[model samples]
Target: MWVLTSQFSRNLTSHSSLLSYLPDVKVGKTTDTGKFWDPHFDIHFCYKPNMKWSVLFVLGVLSWGNTLATMVPKEATFYQLDCPKEGTLQYFMLKRSGQAMMVDNTYKVMEQNITIHSNGSIIFHSLKVEFEGTHLCVMNHPDNSIHGHEVKLRVRPLPPTDLWGAVYESMFVTGLIAALVIAFIFALGCFVYKKQWRPRPEDEKPVMSGYENPAMNPSDDGESGSTNM
Candidate 1:
């Protein structure tokens, strides 16, 4: 059970191949392109090596049908495999479930061999069990006719999410949210502690107006004073 994934550029005008060897067993197989193939991203799975059972599935599509054939690039051609040296192939299986599926399936693949044959085909061991999915299978000598080149395989599964996206919903608000909250609180406190119209004796005293009071006239003041004496 071995699964291998690869990626390439769409603009090269000619198809290309690569060969790399991975000695580590973690995070799955990774093949970096010695050559850069830009503007094109492709994904496929290789299921079951050397066995009659092999299949390739195109990813990121909603449904599989005739309509998909039309979507495939006319300029793009199928990729072949290549190996550096001759060696016995080793394999492993990995099971993965995604947002598109109800459960995960075990995928089988091998780490890069110290020595593998040129133009070899590889496959995922368990992909056949999952008829509802798409994957890639390796070729016996995909690159023999093509010659020495570097190929990159992208096989690691990404994190999945439910209805809500990964980072779209934010509890964090900036600028206006903080400003409005502070303003509302300040206004509310101001109203509660506001000053009233209550006045002291000085506050009640009247300033000069146009009319004069007859009680305080000079003649009236004199008459009052004479009577008092």
Candidate 2:
């Protein structure tokens, strides 16, 4: 029987905001026809906390097995396991002694914060600071099929809230100042335009009285008035 083991690590620092980490581990086994076996799996984790923190562990199966067609086809069966906690999975608190403990349906050391999903996958959650050290996952089959994987978890400290808050407040104040400056400039431009505005000139009309008409000469009117006098 050939044994396969694969190891991988997923960093939770990438998701610091959410304070959640999900490790992706895949395990599978194949058997010939007329072979019956039960598979067993276990996960091991170690955590030391600088301060008080909480964590959760969840377990589920992704795919059971696939059938192979041949002269004698092998049958594949899928099984689902329940989560460690009965109802809502609670977080396991890690104390100052650098020890992590969880209270749940299962009394196992690392099984406390576990939750089993419909699909078989294990999820571990805790504060970034509280997660440290090496984690191991073991899968065993009755037919001597054993697979193992190693995961190293590392978490970085979150940025100080006061610093981030100050940055946000500064940015908001800067934006407000910029908006006020823009509005003032706009109002000044409108005021200047109104002050500099001038009215357009209208067309002039010619005087057209009986004597002032162009057809009646001013000298003829003067001679007639002199002759009448």
Candidate 3:
């Protein structure tokens, strides 16, 4: 009878040990994979196919949108817009105000000069304080597809006494002085050439006396005496 009691106690302890090793199973919910869900936590963990690719696609779109924005310099003489040259494209520049105006590439719009370069870059010349606003660069492809790039231009007035202003003034003065010096030197050289090449009258020939004239035949006297002897 003691052996039977000890055997029962050993069997009970082995069963308890086995149960402790097993995971705690809840009766709240079961997933499609036959896994039991915890009741306390409301989180649902599932594998989404192509999740990495979806995240990468979202980030690529964000980066592509950022690439379409441009910033113009505040104190620049010109602003350049580099467009993609993948297809036959027509370029258009638009000024955005209360109403959008198509920027003309003519002298009629002298203040806002536009130039299309050999490359696919559009140049906006003579940036002015009035041009401080939003601008759009539109490219129309052969397939009727349109792509737009936006620009925010702000042109600040250059100070009269700034370092760059001083430098420009000094350069202008130096250039003016150099030009004047070159002009003066060229004029002096032209004057000297004219004077040196001027036509002058020839000097008059000196008249010789009869004694100084070899053609008078002074040796004829000695020849006549020898003949007389």
Which candidate ranks first by TM-score, i.e. highest? 3
> What would the per-residue lDDT of candidate 3 be over residues 1-229, giving only the tens digit for each residue?
1111122234544587644733453446868864444555432334446667889999999887766533435444767655567443344454633332333333224456666553456566766666666565566666788777665656666556588889988999999999999999999999998888544456545667867656445465565322232
Q: lDDT for every model?
A: 0.36, 0.39, 0.57
Residue 81 of model 3: what lDDT? 56
lDDT value for candidate 2?
A: 0.39
Give per-model TM-scores. Answer: 0.19, 0.21, 0.29
Global fold similarity of model 3 (TM-score):
0.29
lDDT of 2 at 213: 51
1 versus 2: better TM-score goes to: 2
| Over 4 Å off, model 3 | 1-76, 84-89, 97-112, 117-119, 161-229
Candidate 2 vs 3: which has more lDDT: 3
| Candidate 2 lDDT for residue 99 | 34
- Ranking of models by lDDT: 3, 2, 1
Question: Which stretches of model 2 miss by more than 4 angstroms?
Answer: 1-112, 116-120, 164-229
Which window of ten consecutive residues has the lowest lDDT sum in model 2?
71-80
Model 2 C-alpha lDDT per residue in residues 85-147, reported as the tens digit of each score: 222322232222333233232222343233323222333422234344454333333455544
TM-score (C-alpha, index-matched) for candidate 1:
0.19
Better of 1 and 3 by lDDT: 3
Displacement of residue 162 (Cα, Å) in model 2 is: 1.8
